[model samples]
Every structure is written in structure tokens, then in C-alpha cells.
Target: MTAYKSREEVPLNEKWNLEDIYPNLQSWEEDFKKVGNMIDDVKKFDGAIHGANDLYSYLSLGEELGMVYKKLYVYAMLQVDLDTRVTASQALLDRASQLGQKLSAATAFFNPFLLSLEEKTLQSWIEEVQGLKYFEDDLYELYRYKAHVLSKEKEEVLSQMGEAFSAPRNTFGMINNADIKFGDVTNKDGEKVELTRGMYSKLIEDDNRDTRIEAYKAYYKPYVQLQNTIASTLSAAIKNNVLMAKMRNYPTALEKSLFGDMVPKEVYDNLIKATKENIEPMHRYMKLRKDILQLDELRAYDIAVPLVKDVKQEISFDDAYDTMLKSLAPLGEEYVSTLRSFKEKRYFDVRETPGKRSGAYNLGLYGVHPFILLNHQDDLDSLFTLTHECGHGMHSYLSSKHQPQISAGYSIFVAEVASTVNEILLIRYLLKETEDKHMKKHLLNHFIDSFKGTMFTQVMFSEFEKITHEKSEQGEPLNAEVFNTIYEQLFRVFNGDELVFDDEVKFGWSRIPHFYRPFYVYKYATGYASAIHIADKLLEGDSDTLERYLTFLKSGSSDYPLELLKATGVDLTTPEPIQNALSIFSELVNEFAEL
Candidate 1:
């Protein structure tokens, strides 16, 4: 009963205007050309930062140019994402990517300049120049990586080559979202339904198992046919990781990944170890699913359904936003007031449309406000999603207001904390407010499922990614047969004996776009862990915890992400965060059992 077309057919209202970024493409283009011209100007001060005065001027100029580049990049990117079909938008994206490379190349001297200065000299510069006070922590963080930073030329080469280096990921995304087709599925009413990715999700989450299975199979059929292409993309991505690690003189890809966040190797290893030890919870859940559904066996398609059914409820977008405000009130009045503006201002693109990118994310940039992309539907799930993204928006709002623009962008390691914390708070808020047993059970299922997806499943993915890279390091060729065997083994490992591993499920990796992102999924697990810990602290209603949490949000990239997290009481470098998160998972499972 729904009519659909590409997003351009129903463009967003001006209410979601990005004119704050730039007035128009012409102005953006003008700024882009100005950036190209400023390349030479930046090169002049490269090797001449000798005295404190020179360093101050260099730092201030660098910050100003950085603000310019930030505005240009966010504008072009927002335009491209809004209507990806326009060739002009695609061209702008290409230009913006290239310009970003140029900007990085130009700014390469900042790190080396600081690295060259003795600690006392750097301190002298901070004291002598008031402008540099805001960025003292930023410079200190960069200096922490002085041992890892390569020669300026090598870093510049890496920066310029990054776009080409990330092509495999881009190709996989293009194929999966735009090119591949999932035919159609027969619905409960005997009507044939087209199996677009959006529709596929709706069908899989349906209360009917038959609809879930058929939709899952039909949806993945195209990926099965394109296995070779998918394998090639995976191979290229893995190879890129190995190549980059070697070039950077790191022992392995994992070291390079951990180094960026100042996370020790033990952090990654501990998550894998902790998940392996406690994986039975996931397996037990699978067994519970089989018993609940009265099935002889389960398959990959069965992974998404509720253990207790007939619990679905419809929630509208307006109601969802209102509920988010109610749930977030525990954080105090200022946080609640800012969240209200984001909701009323159309700060989010809240509905799914044809040709729109899938999933949700909060994009932050200097000077411009944070933007969130969401494929929202008016359900309890979507309401939780709204609360989640608003958490991110609010975090970005605070950081931008409290920190220098250069340090306002948070590291990915801690990025998920605010968003997931919002979800936790909302779940607790709803559970406290509702009296109906079904709604209570429904909310509990939602919380349990969040842990299952964000913590457990992503860790499984992190393991898969680690194993894939290790095999690639050992010179094993990543092809259809080899990759399928590995994928099947992981399925068995994660699903235990309860769920049968169907051969069709091997092609599932091809459908995932995140694998192309180097070691990114693990952050989702770490983020949730940090969020839950922070949420518990905030719920205590202690001023110190509240102030510390806010300070952590505003800390941004002022320090290594783990060090910043330590200030907030979550030590990602240790096993405790993962263990704590998993303990909550176990408790949720037991609670669900009692309910």
C-alpha cells in the first residue's frame, strides 16, 4: 500500500537545510579553489617553525585553514549524501576527497614540528601563546604518537593514496546497495513482495517464521550469485590492511589498529578471549529460540526473531521523539533542552526512502552542526534508534561547544558511548513507566537484543575480521572456497550446535559493507561497554560522575581514546569493560527467562 521512489523524488524540506555549511555549490567551489591556491602558502612555513612566536603563528594559521577545509568537506559530503543520484554531487564528492588529501598533506608539518620540539619548548609555546592553550592537549596527544608517525613524505603519500586504497570498500557498498537486486518474496496474504534491502529487514523481523526464512533466502540469493566478486572485494580489503601495516613498520594489522586508539594488544585479545569464554550465552539463546519456536533445527534466518512473540507495537515518529525526551530527562534539564531543539529542527533525516543509504550514523564536523542519517520507521525499535542517535547528537553538541574545533571530533573508540547510553536510559525509562506485562517483556527483549547485537555479535565479527587478516598475513589466498569454509566455521562457532549452518549463509559476508572498514565493528562492542558503564554512573545522580562524564565527552581527541575513557572510569585496555558488558548480557538472559 506504500508508494516509493528515489529520495530525489521526495527531497528533504529546507528545514533540514545545510546552508549552515555553505550557501550553495558555487560558494563551495570557490572555497575549494581557494584551498587549492593555499597549498603553496602552507608549504612556506613547513621547515621554519623555530621559535615560540613562529610556532604560535604556524599553529594559529593551521587552525584557521583547518576550519576552512572542514567547512568545504562537510558541505560537499552532505550534498552528495542527500541526493547521490546527481552526477554533479558525485563530482563534488570526488573533488572533496582529493581536496581532503591535499589538506592532510599540507598539514603534515604540524606533527613533525611538535615532535621536533623538546617537551619544555612545547610547554613554553603553550604558556607564551594564549591561542595555543586550547590545543595543548591536542598537541600532546599527537606527540604521544611521535614514535609511530612516519616521515612527512611517507605520511603525505599515505594520505593521498587513501582514496584509492579505500576503493574496494566503496565498490562493495555500491554493489550491495545500488546494483544488486533481491527479486521478490511471497507475503502472508499470497501477494508477491519485492525484496529490497529495507523491505528485507521488515520481513525478517515479522512475527511469522515462514516470512523471515523466505525473505532471508531470497534476499541473500543475489549475494550468493556474486560470491566471486564479493570474495575479490574481501581479498583486496585484507590485502590493503596488510600492505598498510607493513608500510608503517607495524608487526601486524592489529597493532596498527590498536595503536591509533592507544589501546594495547591485550584489549583486542581480551575481548576475543572473554567472548570465547562466555559464548554459551549466545548458544543458550539460540537453543531457547529453538524451544520457543518448537523447531527441530534453526538456521541463519532464525537469528533475528523474538523468543516470545505477539509482542509487536506500533509507535509514531512524533510519539517516539516525545518518548525520547521523557527517557532522557534523568540527565537533567540542559541536556533535555538541547535534545528538544534537535528533534524540532529536523536535525535528522528520519525516514527510509528508495536509493537512500541504509542504517544510521551521526556525522560531526567543525563549524557545521552534527548531522544524522537514519532509515526510521515508527516502531518501538525506531524510537530507541532515535534516542540513540540523539545521544550522539547531544554529545557532538557538547563537545563542539566546550572544546576547540580541532579537538571536537571524537575518536571512534568512544563515539558509541553516548548513543548506546541513550538507548540504555530509554529502555530503563520505559520499563519504569509501563505496567503491561507484554510491554515490559517487549522492552526487556529490546534491551537483551541490543546486547546480543551490539556486544556479542559484533565481537564475533571482530573475531572473523581478525582471523581473516591473520590468514591473509600467512599468505593464504582469499577466494570463494577458502572464504566460505572460514565463514561456515565461524557460524558454527558462534551459533553452537543449536542452529544448522546452511551453505547459503557462506555468501553472507559478501553482503556486509563494514568488513571493508578496517577493524571498525569492534568499536561497537567497546562503545556499548563504555556507554553502559557511564550510564550506570550518571544514574547514581552524583555531581562528580555527571561532571566527569561531560568532561569526557568534551575531551574529544585531546588524548588517546582509551586514556580519555580511563578518565571516565572505563579502561578499554583491560578486560573488565568487555567482561562487565557480557555480565549484563548474562543477567538479561536470566531476567528474560524469569519473565
Candidate 2:
């Protein structure tokens, strides 16, 4: 394997075109000042939004100001992620954050005031002001939460407390990413390699079982040591969620978290149910791994190692791009052409450089093209990661083009659907093209592993979150012991008796960062299920399904996520999507067994 490249050494074309956002710092500073000036202008219409003319003006100004805010904020954030060690870039990011808080405080009264208006009067204003029709859905979305909208003074207090509430998550990050040391472990090649969150994935996937076990133990040791502190931080975070939910009149923290994204509790519950019902397939997969690897007993660390060795292929970045475009051809020529344009335009930062952020994501700014950050490793996984981020880019492109700035962003509930759909398509294309039995088994392993990771593991985490929050609400002490016991039980339930776990597995909850964001992981499960169903339809050559899926992408936040998905023929509110996805998982497991 090649060593990672520095940012300066990477080819210019491989990096993202930050100039597309702004030519230089001076240009960004100009927009920064312009947005700062507009915050004051936005506040002028605070009390005047009651009238039809003022309402129209306020909406238009708010949209334009929002577009500028997104551009400034995204530019700074993308810059900072490129090299977080740069003080100037960090300062720019901080300035953007402060500006966001200022704008939020300045316009905090808009929602309360709008909700205060009688429905009849608001409707009359919408009819009288022709431009207000453009903001009809935006207004109605706010109105939907009228019952939850607090008084202006109270809302301001809550808004100001935002930074304080973020302490637990920040503390968790500092400990996990900066403080905790995993130490070094010797690999099977007799070389000492440092254990890290990023390295853990690669190590666990190694063909050598002893190497995986060593890395897993080393990687989780710090988490076990800091279990109490991590548990305390998580408890505080959960309490914050519960307090906020009560303040907003929500019955439960889960309900409060889901309500904001317009997701029903039934969706969360259904995912858990479907996962439980499908454990037999998971057990079968586990047995197959044990059989193929010729292990006496299957351990958690043994699960991720490839079943077929020497089948790993290194794919160049250019080949990955071509494969992605071909895999996504079901979306039509226009979609493929636009994706090709993104590649040519250098919309992606495609190399892992010193100080660059880990993982991959697509950052979508309102007034600029979506920017993708990737630490490309030139493997099948990297290829899939490229496709996933591009899915997000395409989604953002379509939404921004079709909707107003005010409604261009989609909910997190449906955000993962487009990305996971691309992965499914790419996997199908590879499976069809590969003729080697070992290669086919490797691809099948990838598919099963993805299902287990996204669907099974996330749902397991979601269940753990639900139980812990419920216990905390019931006044149970949320110390390390309490958390470990709950986590161990859930692990047993999910993994069944076929698999064995080390003691360190109990502290696994302490390592997961998503616990800070209550009830968020379930969306990964729901999104995967939705993506599977949609990908299956499109792959079956349903032209109308592709059209509907594209429309779903462009719909953005104009409708509730459930409604948007329903329009795309996937009703997440029901259990059918989850069951269908699991059925596909079962079929894939059988295929892998035969291979």
C-alpha cells in the first residue's frame, strides 16, 4: 500500500475547486461583510411582517440572506476541514459560526410572530401577496409546529442555551479524538502499527484473525478505561434532550427528535421489529463466515475479515469514476452527464493528505455547486464511497435547481436514501460484470457486510439509545455499570448465542459518538431500507420509477419526508420496506452460501 499524500503533493485537479465558492480570502471576506450587514436589514422587518407587503418582502429578503449565509458558512467549513491545523481557517470557521448565531438571534421572532397570526389572516395575506405563494409550504411547515413554538422570550432563552447544550458532544469528541490513546499493536507482518479509529476498520478487515483480534483489543482498551467518563457525558446529553423535549411539550425525547424531521415513531419501531425478525439470516451469515474462515468459534473481531482471500483488487480513481457513471446509468443520460461534469469541474477533493478530515461527505451550499471531501484509498470501498458522496451531490444539485433557497435542504430522515441507492446500484453492476467465483463471493460479502453495518448495527444502536433514554427518564442511575449491562444484553439479543464477545464489547456504547445525537442512528437503518426498495425498482427497468425517484430528489423539504418517500413509492411509515430489504439480505446470504 502507498503512503498517504500531502495536500501540496496531490495533483491540482484532484482537489476540490474552492475557487468556485470564492476566488480568494478577500472575496470570501467581502461576502462575509455583506452577510453581516444583511442581518441588520433582516431585523428591520421583524415587527413589520404582519402586513401583506411586509410579509412578501420579509420572505424574499430572508431567502436571499439565507443563500448568502450558506455560501459563507460552507466555504469556511470546507476550508477548515481541508487542514484543521490552520489557525486562519479555524478563525474563519468561528466567524461564520458567530455570524450564524447573530442571524438566528436577529430573526428569532419570525416563527413565533408568524404562528401568532390567525390562520384566516395568514391565508388572506398569502392570497393578497402573489409572491407569498412561493413561500406557502415554508409558512405551513412552521405552522405545523405552532403547538410547540414557545413565547419569543422563552425561545430566545433556548436559542442562547444552544452552545451550552453542545458541551457534552464537544467534550466527547475531545476525549475520543484527541485525548484517548489506543496505543500500538504489532500486525501479522511483525510491524508495529498505531491503532486509531480509522485504522480499526482496516485492521479488523485483515485476513489474519490474530491481527484483527489484537487490533480490536488495542483499539477498544481506552474506551473501556474511560467508560465512566464517557457514560457521564452521554447521560448529560440524554438529559439535555429530555429537558428540551419537555420544554417543547413533547412526550418523549425520541418523539421530539423525530418530530423535527417529520418522521413518525412507527418508522423507528418498525425498523427494530424488522431487524429482530431477520436475525436468522444474520445468524446464517455468521455461520457461513465461521465455516469459510475455518474458525472454531466466531468472535466479533472475526466478522469483518473477508471470506475470500487474495481476491482484493485495487481500483484507480479514474476507473472508480467510470464504474460509478456506468452503474448509475439507470438514472438516465442527463443525470450521468451532470455527474461527469462534476468530475471534470473538480468538485471533489479526492486524496488523503496530512491534517485532512477522515471519512467522506458532500457539502451542499445554496448558491454554489456541492463540494465533496474524500480520502480516496483506491479500493472497492473507496469506489463505493465516491459513488455515495456523488449521490448526495446529485441530490443537492437537483434540489437547489428546482426549489427556492428556503426549501432546498432535505431532511436527514431521507438524506441517506440517495447515497445508499447509489451503493446498491454499483454493487449490482459489479456483481453482473465479475466472472470469478472468488470475486463474486467477495462482492456478496461486501453487500452482506453493508447490510449488517448499516441496517443491523445501526438499529442495534438505536435500540440501545431508546432503552437508555427511557431508563434515564424513569430516573434510573445512568452510570457505567447501568450502561454496560443494557448494552451487553442488547448485544446478546442481536448477535445471538452463535457469537462470543470479549469483556471490552460491553464498553462499546462509550465509543459510539452518535449517542450524543439522540435517536439519529435509526435513520441510517430506515434510509438503507428505503434505498434498497427504490434501487430494486429502478434496476428492474421501471422508467417511471426512475422519474419518480428524480422528482423525490428535487422535492427537498417542500413536503414531509414521509410524503416525499411515498411519492417515490416507498412508504417508510409501514413495515414493508424494512421487511423487503431484509428479504433481499436473506437472498444474498443464500447466494454467498452457494458460492
Candidate 3:
């Protein structure tokens, strides 16, 4: 395998073409100034929502400001991610973030003012004003929250106080990502390997049980020591959620969070219920792992290791690109061609370099092509990750192409669908093409792992969030003891008697940063479930199915996520999709067991 390269060492073609967004730092600064001026320009129309003409002008100006702000923020953040150690880049990102907050505060009056307007009056304006007609969906969406929106003064206060409200999550990031240290563990070769958050996934997957155990313990040590601090931080976050929910007149934080996406609480409840009903498949898979590994007893750390040995396949970047394009062929020539065009245009920052951000994501801007960041390792996992993120890129590409600036960005509720769909397609393609028994088993294991991580594991986290929030609402203190007890019980319930939990397992919640974003993790489960159903239809070579899925991607935030998904023939309101995904998981487990 090739060694890691610095950004300077990586060839130009292998890096993302950020120049497309801004030609140089001078260009970026010019846009930054433009955003500041636009922020001031927007405040002039603060009280202008009374008439049709003012409303049109206000909406038009808001859209323009939004477009410019998104470009500025995306560019700054992307630059920072390229090399976080650069002080200048960090300063640029901070400036952009501050500008964003200023814009938010400036626009706070718009929602409250819109809510003040009578529905009949707003409808009349939409009909009479030509410019307002373009934002019909935007206007309707604003009206949907009329009940939840506060008075103009209150809304402005909330908007201005947004940074303060985010203190818990911000502090959590500092402690979890910056301060906490996981120390080191001895590898199978008897060399000491430093353990970090990024290494946990790969470490847990090591074939050596001893290495996994050591790493798991080492990683959880700091978390356990700081459990009290972490618990307090989480409690504060929950309180923030509860406070916001109460202020919005929503009965619960989950309702308040899901309301924005138009997702009903039943969807969340149905996912947990469905997963609980389908827990047997996961238990069986766990038992299979124990049997295959011939372990006298399975521990939490043992679950991630592969059942099939000697199946580690390293895929090159070029090979991964070609495979991703081929795997997506079910979406037809146009989809494949668009993705291929991205590859040819150097859309991805494809290698890990010093000071570069870890993990993978597709950063989409309104007017420019989507940019993908990847710390690409030469393995099957990296290959699938590339496909998954490219799935997001394609979704963004299509959405931006088809929708207006206001509605182009999709919601978190449906964000993971396209990405997971791409992963499923990639797995299917790999399985069909590979004749090697071990490789096939590896692919099957990969499918099982994906379901476990995205579906079962995320649902488990979802349940934790739900229970904790409910507890907080009930006036139960969320200290370390309470938090640990809750987490331990849920872990045992999900894993069953097949796996053993060390004491360190209690601190696992401390490390999961997703808890900071309450009720956000469950969408991964829903998205995966939806993707499984959609992938099956598209893989069947049905042209209409393919077209509907494409249309769903392009719909963006124009409609509610659930409705858009329904159009794509995946109804998330029901538990059927989750059940279907679980059935697929069971089938894969059975296949892996046979192999």
C-alpha cells in the first residue's frame, strides 16, 4: 500500500477543484465583503412584509443573500478542512460563521412578520405578485410554522441568542474531540499503537480479539473518568431542547425537532418498535460471529471483527471510481454520465494528508458543483465510502439543478437515502461480479455490518436519546449513574446475552457526539430502511421506478420528506420499510453463516 501523502505531495488532479468556487483568496475576500454588504442591505426590508411588492422584494433579496452566504460559508469551511492547522483558514471560517449568525438575526423578523399576515392575505400576495409566485413553496412552508413562530421581538431574541443556545453542543465538541485522549494500546505485533477516535472503527475490526479489547478499554478510560462532565453537558443539551420545545408549544423536544421536517412522531416510534421486533436477526448474527470465531464468550468488542478471514481486499482509487460508476448503472446512463463527469472534473479531494479532516462528506453549494472530501484508504470500506458520499454528491447535483435556490437543499430526514442507496447498489454489484467465495462472504459481511451500524445501532442510539429526553422532562437528573444505567440496559437489550459488556461500555455514550444533536441519529435508520426498499426496485431494472427515485432526489425541500419518499414508493410513515431492511439483514446473515 502507498504511504499517506501531504497536500503538497498529492497531484493536482487528485485534489478537489476548489478554484471553481473561488479563483483565489482575493476572490474569496471580495465575496466576504459582498456578504457583509448584503447583510446590511437585508435589514432595510425588515418591516417590509406588509405589501405584496415589499414581500416580493424581501423574499427575492433574502434568496440572493442566502445564495451568497452559502457560497461564502462553504468556501471558508472547505478551506479550513483542507488544512485545519492554518490560522488564517480558521479565522476565515470564524468570520464566515459570524456573518451567518448576523444574517440569521437580520432575517428573524421575516418569519414572525409572515406569521402575522393573515393566510388569506399571504395567498392573495402570492397570486398577485409575480416574484412572490416563485417562492410559493417557501411561503407555504413559513405559514406551516405559524403556530410555532413567536412574535417578532421574541423571534429576534431567539435568533440573536442562537450562539449562546448552542453552548452545550460546542462545549461537548471541545471536550470530546479536542480534550479527551484515548491513550494507546499494544497491537498484535507487540508495537504500541496510539488510539484516537478515528482509529476506533478500524481497531474494533482487528482480527485479534486481544487487540480489540485493549483498544476498547483504552479508548473508554478517559470517557469513564469524565463521565460526570459529559453527562452534565448532555443534560444541558437536553434542557436546551426541552426549553425550545416548550417555547414553540410543542409537547416534546422530539416533536419540536421532527416538526420542521414534517416528520410525525409515529415515524420515530415505529422505527424503534420495528427494530425491537426484528432484534432476533441481529442476535442470531451475533451468535454466528461467536461460533465462527470459536470464542468461548463474545464481548462487545468482538462484534466488529469479520467472521470470514483472509478476505481483506485493497482497492485502488482508480478502481474504486470505475466500480462506483459501474455500480450506479441501475440509475441509467444520464446518472452514470453525470457522476463520471464529476470524476473527470476532479470533484473529489481523494487522499488523506497532514492536517486534513478525517471522514468523508459531500459539500454542496447552490451554484457550483459539489465537492467531496475523503481520507481514502485502499480497502473495500473506503471504496464503499466513496460510493456513499458520491451518492450524496449526485443527490446534491440533481437537486441544485432542478430546484430553486430556496428549496434546493434537502432536509436531514431524507439526506441519507441517496447515499445508502448507492452503498446497497455497490454491494450488489460487487457480489454479482466476485466469484471468490471469501470475497463474496466478505461482501455479505459488509452488507450485514452496514445494516448493523446504520439501522440497528442508530436505532439503539435513537432509543437512548428518547429515553434520556423523557427522563429529563420528568425531572430526573441525568448524572453519570443514571446515564450509564440507561445506556447499559439499552446495550444489553440490543445485543442480547450473546455479547459481554465490560464496565467501560457504560461510557460509550460519552464518546458519541451525535447525542449533542438530539434526535438526529434516527434518520440514519429511516434513511437506510428507505434506501433498501428503493435499491431493490431500481435493481429490478424497472424504468418507472428509476425515474421516480430520480424525481424524489430532485424534489429537494419543495415537499415534506415523507411525501417526497412516498412519491419514490418508500413510505416511512409505516414500519414496512424497516421490516424489509431487517429481512434483508437476516437473509445476508443466513448467507454469511452458510459460507
Candidate 4:
């Protein structure tokens, strides 16, 4: 709730203790130098690897280098995200990134060389070396990409271009985080101030209709002004994915993205199909929103405003943390206690300040702790965001603690389930705990809105990604107009005909940073559905589900994401989870209407 003029202005408790990572810049440099030497040492194994001992040596060296690389990259990344405008941190990240490209290039030959060996020979070698048994599963997994693995020479070349491959994403990150500026808005003091993402967040939901309209237009102005530029960046990113998929012999770009998790292309397509088939509830909710707001027409900004405006509660950060902990008691004391320690240990960068990255995320370093970035506004929405990210942090923490370094990290697919499960639990607890009907109704509205944002909107983005990527594969030109047209069309289709269109609405794709990641947003929807199922079971006191779910968290990438999720009795390969979630949404809308 307090304004922070600079990163220094934020309390030490609210800021991250990066010293936990490096202790000092000298240590970071030492690790950077260490990685460089390891990269050189790793390159020596290229042609020299002959038998089991050579293979063991290469794999072990690569694994150690990987641990160091993660620490370096994560430390630099946390620095830049805390304050993007710091050139020193930017330089550190740049050095770390270049170091990563070198590491990638050095090891790129290993994969190609790996697939070159006959399965029988590799198995014999695995039988020959005991250390290799540690890497047996991952080593065998490379065979899954046998057809996709390029020649050693080509792999090396591609790996050298790692920075270039990520250029568009980095460019967009700078634009979104450091360079672009929102238009001015009138603050509570009746002074015109430059609008920030943190300010726009609250202003867009202002009770004053005129203020909301002003904030909405102002918030979108910069994005609209730079639409063509952003369109070009996004177009490049999509084309790059298409090219990578083609080069790797994938049938489609979407399939290429899914291949890592061994998820069937049908799963991706089915998610979209099932959601569209059951989309009437979503459309009905929009109409309900229109009526509840008493508006002749709903607009883009109106979508996020709470329908139950009179039942506002000003929850502070400590209160929000306490509420989140109490709400998560169903997960057992260990989970709740571990989460509380994360706050006490300064693992979170909790305040929004000048040039800090907008939005919230939890990044878990396998060896280090999970660093969560939040722009806390000390309101109900912030409470939900806190619980959501803590889910991810707990997942990261538990997985790292329980699993080996190799399997400690999780895929994006299973990652969302952990976070969304926490969110649903928090909402369920709040809904049951509230004594006032008005407050309960407000909580219900919050749940539905969160559901809409997480499930429906992400599916819409997934489709948008699908369509645009297909356009690139078909050799159609992608530019500002094309992107705007596709986005506006999808927006209308998903939200139904109840809303009026604005110019700012069409440019929505230009503003989403996730679009740069290529075919990644659909997991949010799928995970939301999966979380709904898991959270409901937990609410019913299904101890078996809780134990399996906890084990699922610690399992990490030990198995494919789907297998991990299936182990918890939520099979995303089937339609039941999504349908169950949609049914719940319909029920919530009905209950909300009754209220």
C-alpha cells in the first residue's frame, strides 16, 4: 500500500536476500569463471568419448556444470527482475546468458552423439558404468527425440545461436518491463502522475466509472502506439518456432512444443475442443456480468472489476499471509510451516518499485530457494495472488528437497496445478469462513473471475497461438493487422456477442508476454481444471488424494508431467477434469445469480 520510490526504499524484509545465492559479486564471478572452465572441459569430451568410462565422465561433468549454470542464471535473473533499469544487473545477466550459450554449444554435441549410439551399446555401457545408472532414465529419454536430433555439427551451430533464438522474448521483456510507459492517470491526491502497471491494476477496477474508463484507455495507450513493433517481434517468435519444429521433423509447431512432455497432439486439440463445446456457461457468465454491473454494454476494462463492489475488505500483507496459511491447513502443517519460512527467510521480492518487472511469478532454482516476485496491493486479489504463487514455491521447495537434482525441476504443465490448487483451496476456505452473505457473494464473484481469467482466457490465448503459428507454417504474412484481426475474432467468439469492441481490444495480443513463449498458455487452463478436481478432493478430506498429491509434487520431472498428474488420480488425457470444472463454473454462476 505504500509507494516505493526505489528498490532501496523497500524494506529489507520485502526485498530478496540475493546474498543467499552468491554472498557477493566476487562469488558470482568465481562461479562464472568456474562454468567457463567446465564448458571448456566439457567440449574436450566431444570426440574423445569412447566407452562407458568416457561416457560417465562426460555426463557427470555436464551435470555438475548444469548445476552451476542454473545458479548463475537464476541469481542474475533475480537481480534484473528486482529492478530492470539497473545496468549493472543487466550486465551481469548478459554475461550469464553468454555463458549459458557457451554451455549449450559445448553440450549440444552430446545429444546428437548420444542418439548415434545403438540402444544395445548404450544399455551395455549403462551396465558397464555404475554412475551412469543415475542418468539412465534421462539418457534413455534422448532416444525419444531420435528423429529430431540433428547432426553434431548442426546441433553445435544451433546451440551457439541460443541468444538469437531468445532475442524476441528478451526484446519484449525489455519493452514490457523497462522501456514502455503507460499514459498519465490522476492519483488520489488529484495530481497527474505517470501511470505504472501497479497503479493501472487498481485504477482499472475503480468504483468511479469515469476513472475506470480513463485508466483503461491510458493503460492501453502505449501498447497501441507500439502495436506494429510488438507485432513484428511476436511474428519473428512464431516463425522461429515453426522453423525449429520443421527442422526437427515435427508435424506441427504445436506438436513440437508438446513432444517434450510426451503429450499427444490430440490432448492439446482436445482441450480446445472440449472447452468450446462447453463454452455456453462462459458466455452466460458474461451476460450475468453485464446484468450485475447494470450496464447496457460491457467493455474490456469492466471484465476485471468485482461485481460485488460494496463488500470490500482491506487485507494487509501480514493478514493476507496469515489467511493464506490458515486456508492451506488442509495440506497439513508441514506444507503450511514450510511456506511460512519462505516469507521469514526473505525469499520473496514483495513490493513493486521503479522498473521492477510487473505481475507475479515463482522461479525455483534447483539448488537454491524459490524466488517469488509479487506486486502486492494489499487487497483480496493480492491475497489470491499470494496463495497462488506460494503453491508454486512450495512445489519448488518440496521437489528440490525430495528429489535429486536431475528430477527436481517440473514442467510447466504440472507446475500450474500446484499453484491453482492452492488458489482454489484459499477461495474455498474464504467462502466457507465468511459470515456475511454480501462478503460470501463477493468471494464467490472473486472465484468466478479468477476462474474466468485462468481457465477461459488462457484457452482463448492458446487458440490464438495455434492460429498464428499455423499462419506462419502456411507461409502467410503475419503483421499488426493480421494479429489484431485474429485476436479480435477470438476475443469475440470466446466472450460471446455481449461485449462491445474497442480498438484497444484487438491489440490484446501485443501486450501478452506469454505469447512470446510459444504454445505455453494452454497449461494454465488444463491445470486449472486439474486443480479444481484435486482441490475438491482435498476439501472432501480424501487423505489418499492428499498423500498422492504431495508425492506428486516431490516427484517433479521424475516422470512425464501427465504421468505425474495421473498418479494423483487426475488424468488430463480424459475430459472429465475439464468438464467437472466447467460444471462448477456453471453452478457458481447459478448460485451467484440466485444471490
TM-score of each: 0.93, 0.96, 0.96, 0.99
Give the lDDT of residue 162 in candidate 1: 78
Task: Quantify all predictions' global Cα lDDT against the true fold.
Answer: 0.79, 0.87, 0.87, 0.91
Q: What tens digits encode model 4's per-residue C-alpha lDDT throughout 1-595?
A: 6888888788889888999888999999999999999999998998899999999998899888999999999999988888888899999999999998888888888888888889999999999999999999999998999999999889989998878989999899888888888868887788999988888888888777788888989888889999888998999999999999999999999999999999988788888888899889889989998998999999988888888877667888889999999999999999999999999999888888887888999999887799999999889989999999999999999999999999999999999999999999999999999899999888888898898899889999999999999999999999999999999999998999998997899999988999999989999999999999999999999999999999998998999999999899988888888888999998998899899
Instruction: Count backbone clashes in candidate 3.
Output: 0
Give the local distance difference test score of model 2: 0.87
lDDT of 3 by residue, 148-175 (tens): 9998889888988888888889788767
Full-model lDDT, candidate 4: 0.91
Score candidate 1 by lDDT: 0.79
Write down the TM-score for model 4. Answer: 0.99
Which 10-residue span in candidate 4 carries the lowest summed lDDT? 305-314
Model 1 over residues 1-595: C-alpha lDDT tens digits? 2234555544454125677677877888788888777776777788888777777777777777777877887777766666556678778888888887888778776676678779988898789878777767767877767777788777777887878888898888778767888998997789997877667767887877788888988988888999998899889999999988888778899888888677888888888898888887777877877887788888878877766677776777778888899888768798888888875666777667666677877887666678888777667777888888888888888888887777788878888888888899888888889998877877777788888888877887898889889998999888878878877787788779988877788776777788988788888898998888888777777678777877887777777788888888888877888888888888877777788
Best by TM-score: 4
List CA RMSD, all candidates: 2.5, 1.8, 1.8, 1.0
Candidate 4: where are CA atoms >4 Å away? none
Query: lDDT per residue, candidate 2, 181-216, as tens digits?
Result: 789988667888777556677889898777888898
**In candidate 3, which residue ranges exceed 4 Å CA deviation?**
187-189
In candidate 4, residue 408 scores what lDDT?
92
Error of 1 at 10 (Å): 5.4
- In model 2, pairs of residues that clash are none
